[model samples]
Target: MRMVFRWFGEGNDQVPLQHIKQIPGVEGIVWALHDIPAGEPWPTDRIKEVKQQADQFGFHIDVVESVNIHEDIKLGLPTRDKYIKHYITTIKRLAEVGVKVVCYNFMPVFDWTRTELFEKLGDGSTALFFDNEKIKDIDPMELVEKISSNTSVTMPGWEPERLKSLAKLFEQYEHVTEENLWSNLQYFLEKVIPVAEQHDVKLAIHPDDPPWSVFGLPRIMKNRDDVERLLNLVSNPYNGLTMCSGAFGADPKNNVPDMVNEFIDRIHFAHIRNVKNKGNKSFIETSHRASDGSVDICDVVKAYHENGFTGYARPDHGRHIWDEKCRPGYGLYDRALGIMYLWGIWDSLERSKKVEA
Candidate 1:
């Protein structure tokens, strides 16, 4: 596995590329033009600029976390074609700059939902928490306020412009059902996957955060069967999955290692984080260590190793350890620790394979 770190950009992220470079085994950055709104074509110059920065640090910009999908595309609105045309242009440009994978999600209204960004754990370190019962009672607007209140660092899915028209956005999804979402997603993949294939860029769709619907929104990418249907829908190597453990682990039914084994080839990027399933559809992101969370992270890595995975992997959301005043889940300390844990597993596996030989 080729490990990468997620860096928001020069001015946006608290963690610097130099710090990321210090992490052993991290070779690249998973980045995005966060200032750009969804649906618009990314400026080629801006893409080159980010690449230049990474080049300065001697890190490859091989993967981008998101090129946010416009609500128009998800809702299958009349204007979707226009946005999709722009998306194709963005993909072509990213490929030109050596980006191999683009990770995005189809979660409506919100990309990921959480009741608390900093729920203090027993160790006094805080992590992103999701309470199943609490989410049902909380008002969507109130949740939006809680997540968006901090204006310094922009949340990926909860952009200010999108939330400014929250009521209207919800209205657009009023008639969208799960089937509608699947059809629209298929429509999107059909148009873009070919372009991605032509440019050697893999379009990786991140599973719905929590792997379930939130706030009455339809979520189609939530379970193993859902992924089976998704891969079959497009049936192309270029159309793939991001294979996020924390997202799928929220649903206890998802055996993350098995999913890794089954779709190993189709998975172009891996978000290897752990989540302690709190039962009844609630979870909290945890340390990448196997004992700290419910997901068997070791087995997950073994599946990838056993399957001969050579794709990009990154340490996903981590605890806000060491009193780090950073983005809710994108803190540097715990994630760097997570990377070492993963490297330990991967290295041990490699040694065992050589011994067998």
Candidate 2:
């Protein structure tokens, strides 16, 4: 597996490429034009600017976290065609810049949901935590206000501009059922996948955070079965997955390593992190070590290692360790430490193979 780091941008991200460069085995940055709104065509000039920035640090701009799908497309509205055209344009430009995988999600309204961004653990370090009861009881707007006001850096899924019309967005989704959402996603892939295939770019859909319905939003990409359905929906290699262990592991039934092996061919990117299942559909993000979390991260790493995975991988989310004041899960210290832990597991597996040979 090729290791990549998620870098927001020069001014946007607190963690710099200089620091990320120090992490062993990291090959590139998993990035996107975060300032660009969903469905808008990503400017070619801006794309090239990001390329130049990555080139400075000898990092490939190979994977984008998202080219966000517009709500019009998700709701299957008539105006979706315009947005789809813009998405296609963006995809073609990203391919031109050598971006092999574009990671996107189909989760309705919110891309992901959490009760608290910095829930304290026993170690006094903070990590992203989800409380099942809190989400059910909390008002969506209050949750948005709580999260948006907490951090200046825009969180990946909770874009402030979209949430401004929280009431309206919820209204739009009132009539959208699971089946309707699935059909909408299929419609999107049918149009976009062919273009991605032609340009040698893989459209890797990220699993829903918590991997289930949150606040009544339909989350289709949850487990192995959902992945099977997704692959069959568009039977092309370019139409792939960014299998996130933390997302899938939220539900204890999901065998993350098993799923990794099962979908090896179509998994274009990997977000390898650990999540401690807190029962009743709740989970907390943990360090990348297998021992720290419920997910067997060692086995997950081995699953990819044995397959000789060539796809992009990143240590997905991490705790805010060392009292570091940074983005909730995308902190510098813990993630850097997580990288070493991942490298340690992978290298040992490699050594074992060599010894056997």
Candidate 3:
């Protein structure tokens, strides 16, 4: 497995590429033009700007976290065609900059939901927490305010401009069911996957965080069966998954290692993080250590190593350790620590193979 670090960009992220470069095994940056809104075509010059930044640090910009899907595309509106046309152009441009995999999600209304941005852990370090009970009671707008109030940066999926029409977006989705979401997603993949294949870019969809519905929004990409159905929807090698462990592992039903084994080939990019399930669909992001959270991260890495995974893998969301004043989960300290933990497990696996041989 090849390691990469997600950097929001020069100005948007607190973590610098130099700091990312210091991480032992990280060879690339998982990035995107965060300033650009969803559905808009990413400008060629803007794409080149990020390339120049990564090039300066000798980091390959192989994977982009998203070219976010517009709500029109998800809602299956006629205006979607216009946005999709723009999306196709963006893909072609990203290909020019050497991006290999593009990760995007289809979670309606909200990309990922959480009650508390920083809930204290036993170690006194804080992490992103999801309170299942509170989510049901809290208003979506109130949740939006809560998230916005905490972070200076615009949280992905919870962008203010997008949420401006929050009630309208929810009203539009009132009639849209899970099946409708699946159909809309299929419509999207059919148009873009071919372009992705032609440009040698794999389109990877991140599973819904929490792997379940939030605020009564329809969530189709939530579990093993959901992932299986999505892959089968297009049935092409270019059509792939981002394979986020924290999202899938939060659900006790998902055997993460088993899922890794089954879908390793289809996984083009991996988000390897851990989440401790608090029960009844709530979880808090934890350090990447296998024992620290419910996910068997050690075995998950071993599965990828044993499968000879050549794709990009990144240490996903981590605790806000060391009093780091940074993006909620994109902090440098814990993620760097997490990467080392992953390397520890993977390097040991390699040595064990050698000893066995």
| Candidate 2 clashing pairs, residues 3+ apart or interchain | none
Q: What TM-score does prediction 2 earn?
A: 0.99
- For model 3, the run of ten residues with the poorest summed lDDT: 153-162
- Prediction RMSDs, each to the true structure: 0.8, 0.8, 0.7
Which runs in model 3 stand beyond 4 Å of their true positions? none
Residue-wise C-alpha lDDT for candidate 3, range 5-90, written one tens digit per residue: 99999888999899988999889999988889898999999899899989998999999998899999999999999999999999
Superposed on all Cα atoms, model 3 deviates from the true structure by an RMSD in Å of 0.7
- For every model shown, the clashing-pair count is 0, 0, 0
Candidate that beats the other on lDDT, 1 or 2, i.e. the better one: 1
Candidate 1 error regions (>4 Å): none
Tens-place lDDT digits, model 2, residues 1-357: 889999999899999899899888888999988989888999999999999999998999999999999999999999999999999999999989898899999988798888889999889998999999899899999999999888999788888778888899998988789899999999999999999999999999999887888888887888899999999999999999999999999999999999989999999999999988888988899889899999999999999998889889999899998888898899989988989999999889999999999
**What lDDT would candidate 1 get against the real structure?**
0.93
